[model samples]
Target: MKIELLAPTSAALPTLVVAAGERASVRFLEFFASAIRNPHTRRAYARAAGDFLAWCAGAGASSITAVQPLHVASWVELQTQTHSAPTVKQRLAAIRHLFDWLVTGQIVPHNPAASVRGPSHTTNKGKTPVLDATEARQLLDSIDVSTPIGLRDRALIALMVFSFARIGAALAMRGEDVYVQQRRLWVRLREKGGKTHAMPCHHTLEAYLHAYLEGTGIADDPRGPLFRTVARGTGQLSDTPLPQANAYAMVRRRAFVAGIGTKIGNHTFRATGITAYLKNGGTLENAAAMANHASTRTTQLYDRRRDEISLDEVERILV
Candidate 1:
């Protein structure tokens, strides 16, 4: 019962009629437009809400106002059968928060999801595939820096691994974000929640950055995007900023060429960097600070030092 956007002009701005009558959908639309600030969160919540409301409509609920705690519980229970615990919990949170927004806006009597409990989930480890120290070094050294694209690729990957930068923050940088502070290169990241995080570049990262910047000749264009798309037919970077999808594709290609076959994504470097740091006697608090995490618990997920111990123990069980 997924609702398809009636208007095709812009997929994101689709008119979704959630309630029974068209009139009750105003608050539903406004909830996403005004209440949600993060685009990723907004998109996810909208999908969850849309899916739930469509289900409710099929379940004979009259309108948004008629949605009850029973309906929320029923949907949540259904989700548990097909989705992972974390995903179920996230979807439930989306519903609960949306209803809360509607309640405060006077669109509904009360939140239907207020008492609903999501599935239980807890983990000390994250799922991001990380490279070992040797593998990480091999991957970095494998990149040939003969072309502008090659230089850019090596630098971008090094930045993430050395500085523990999130992909979004790394791509969002302007050329000016890389600057000389106290005669050493430093990077400024506009991280999640719009927090400005600044970290001194690792000496290796500094070398890669200098190579990319100087080789590209875009260093003087301080206001231009730090990472640019390779222009079609020119074998050089275009003025347009590199998109996240393109970055992912480049990473996959590089990994494949390097003959390393662990299914990795952008977050792989961040986890690899943190694990490397912690293995060298770095503290959890310092790792949290470097990774711009609000809590050490989140930082702990990236610490894969325990992974080595687990591997060593597994060798004892001879088949």
Candidate 2:
């Protein structure tokens, strides 16, 4: 879906519709859209543009030509009070690109936000919480497998922990994505950033999945949702896929059932899976590849660096 931001043009200036039949504006929009195909990126850009235009209104700048570096700097400062430095920087980048479009289209003299500076922040702080092995076991044991919904939830948790899939990817998955080959179940994941990944299902997951499929009687239709909500009244599973918020709620519910007082969420599984793999002698390179991270640095943050597996220690120094 295309989002439009309309800023009133000055009466003294020619009424130029930025996104209407303008070759440069069209090209710029196409390039920006292509660079960011993810829905999150689109939402971020829409918000940033809204803030910039609102600022423009307050500053008495009706047209793109009236914007100045000071106005851009002021907006950055205002955003920094509520958002992180990286977020502020992202907003600045969006504004810069918008002005560049204006400049290229001859709607503005130059890009005023070109030299606008963004706030700085620490890059090494770990934010995602991870579950230990005990916690993982407790979460699984908390579910009542006697019920069909409980069985389905157990299978979903197993997939998240084993495959390290993002909640969105898990919810977006369809029945056809699961297939049996060579006596092993393979799950096809439609990952973020438009990438496809395959993860091997362990025996435990395979058993749980089999139970869920048979109990729910979910069709083998390739396009149907892999997981669905069984109607409360009729006890029939609906084909609608679960939403991301629903996935988080499921995790929270499981955490409560397991007596885990800590704040566990969908991201916890991702970090826990990566940490468990590495602690079991998996290499950083392989972990990075599995996580689909472009750099090992991103994956390193997920590893528990405090618990070193080294055997070397001087007795005197240790004392």
Candidate 3:
């Protein structure tokens, strides 16, 4: 197979799998190319599978089919020493799923990773840093909306905060995704698993979105990306969509300018908004629905209300 076929993916075929012959190699590539729909997940699984197979080769496995549970377990044990439990667990899950796909294709006699157990992990709270309502407002207000970049940054941040949108879904939006529904602005987000979620824009988000679209003249191109890169040498929006890394840098810079001390990221706005909503009497059930989470349990990870309580108690020591 041409190496270019693997170019579209973030991972390359391991040499052991390549040595296993064309059928195994084809099946290995197909598992990532066909079975996974989400690009991030596909990239992660490919990397995990590639690493495990390479490790097996170093451990004297002749081919991909020769990998066994011991090799899988030993690799996982090594992973635990260097990575966080959640990350290790996710990597293990990636290996297990890939082996299952290989087994189904008859490339392997059995799933070697099926019985391997990952490190134990449990969490009631997520690790994402969250800004309080005051800081969120400060960050938004600090942007100089006289420029197209400022307007776009303010609107993008507000969209994530008010709508509880994941960064992926927020960045995927197009000009047409923001629309009028019942005399109010609404945003339609295409979330994970191809789920379509639409929410009426908060009054604040409505104003920001309106300013961004009209100010940048992006409203004229409804099919174009909503958040875009600034063209070189011109203070204008480019047709190229802003990448996630750029958005992250934008957030960090905006926070520093706004005097916010929290080390925030693209997901910070989502968690900040959820915690703010719950503190203001919004029910967990409603927050889950608004966030388009399949379960309230998943939504709980973003609730940082306990953070305030912990701070309050710490302040009482008065020492």
Candidate with top TM-score is 3
Per-residue alpha-carbon lDDT of model 3 for 263-297, expressed as tens digits?
Answer: 99999999999999999999999999999999999
TM-scores of all predicted structures: 0.94, 0.83, 0.96
Candidate 3 minimal-lDDT segment of 10 residues: 1-10
Order of candidate numbers by TM-score, starting with the best: 3, 1, 2
Residue 136 of model 2, lDDT score: 88
Per-residue CA lDDT of candidate 2, range 92-153, in tens? 98888777766766667888999888887766526777787778888888898887678878
Candidate 3 Cα outliers beyond 4 Å, as residue runs: 1-12
Best by lDDT: 3
Clash pairs, model 2 backbone: none
User: Where is the poorest 10-residue window by lDDT in model 1?
Assistant: 7-16
Please give, for residues 209-259, the per-residue lDDT of candidate 1 as tens digits.
999999999798999999999999999999899999999999998999888
Candidate 2, which segments miss by more than 4 Å at Cα? 1-35, 104-106, 305-319
For model 1, the superposed segments whose C-alpha errors exceed 4 Å read 1-23
